[model samples]
Target: MEMQNITLSLPKPILHRVKILAVQRQSSVSRLLTQAVEKMLEEETEYEMARRRQMALLAKGFNLGFRKPASRDEIHER
Candidate 1:
């Protein structure tokens, strides 16, 4: 994978906290930032997929609510 470098500025207080975290974890600030970004991206992708699935099903008039036991079993069988 290609790598790019960019500069970011953090508030003095936040940067101080990051330094403590980096020392505890024995990781560099950049590494911690990268890991944080990766985790957030994974969650975002999951949210997007779920949203699309909901839209598609709702387009077919599926109400995302509880139903009586009989109606629930009927939909599951199909």
Candidate 2:
């Protein structure tokens, strides 16, 4: 894949912590951030797909197996 470099700015404290985390993980900060962003996008895509499927199911509706509507009296029968 082709990659383009971009500049980013972060607070000193956060950058310091991220550097420590990168060392602990044996990875560079750039790689760590890339993985995190990729994971976030993947989750967002999955959630959107699930939401569309559920919405389609709702739009299609369901069959309750009733030939005719029941009267309120029948429903409230003693």
Candidate 3:
């Protein structure tokens, strides 16, 4: 994979905290940020994929109206 350089401006306090965290974890700030971004992107991708699948399934055949509606007896049994 190709590497890209990214520069971010952060508050001094936040930067100090990040440095402490990096030291405790024994990881560079760049690696930590990269990992965090990758994780969030992966999670967002899954959410998008799931939403698309749900929309597609709904479009094919989904009923908003009730069919063979359950009676109060059915709900009370559980």
Candidate 4:
């Protein structure tokens, strides 16, 4: 796969924390950021797919072998 380079401007405190995390994990900041981005994209894709499936099911509707009550009092009856 082809790779591209991009520059980001972050606050000083945030950059410091990212650098510390990189050192603790023994990985480059670039690699850590890439993994984070990949995970976020994957989660978003999964959410969209699940939402579509749910919408389809809703459109199809369900049959529980149920019928409407004969009277409103029957529904409210305890």
Highest TM-score scorer: 4
Q: In candidate 2, what are the lDDT values of residues 1-78, reduced to their tens digit?
A: 888899999999999999999999999999999998999999999999999999999999999786877789988999
Pairs clashing within candidate 1: none
TM-score of each: 0.74, 0.78, 0.72, 0.80
lDDT of each residue in 13-53, candidate 3, tens digit only: 99999889988999999888888899999999999999999
Q: Any idea what lDDT model 1 has?
A: 0.90
Q: Candidate 3 local accuracy as lDDT?
A: 0.91
lDDT winner between candidates 1 and 3: 3
Off by over 4 Å in 3: 63-78
In Å, residue 13's CA in model 2 sits off its true spot by: 1.6
After TM-score superposition, the amount by which residue 56's alpha carbon in candidate 2 deviates from its true location, in angstroms, is 0.3
Please give the lDDT score at residue 52 for candidate 1: 99
Residue 37's C-alpha lDDT in candidate 3? Answer: 91
In model 1, which runs have C-alpha deviations exceeding 4 angstroms?
63-78
Instruction: For each candidate in the order shown, give its overall lDDT on alpha carbons.
Output: 0.90, 0.95, 0.91, 0.95
Sort by TM-score, top down from the best:
4, 2, 1, 3
Which residue pairs of candidate 3 clash?
none
Model 1 over residues 1-78: C-alpha lDDT tens digits? 676899999999999999899999999988899889999999999999999999988888856696666767787895
Estimate the lDDT of model 4: 0.95
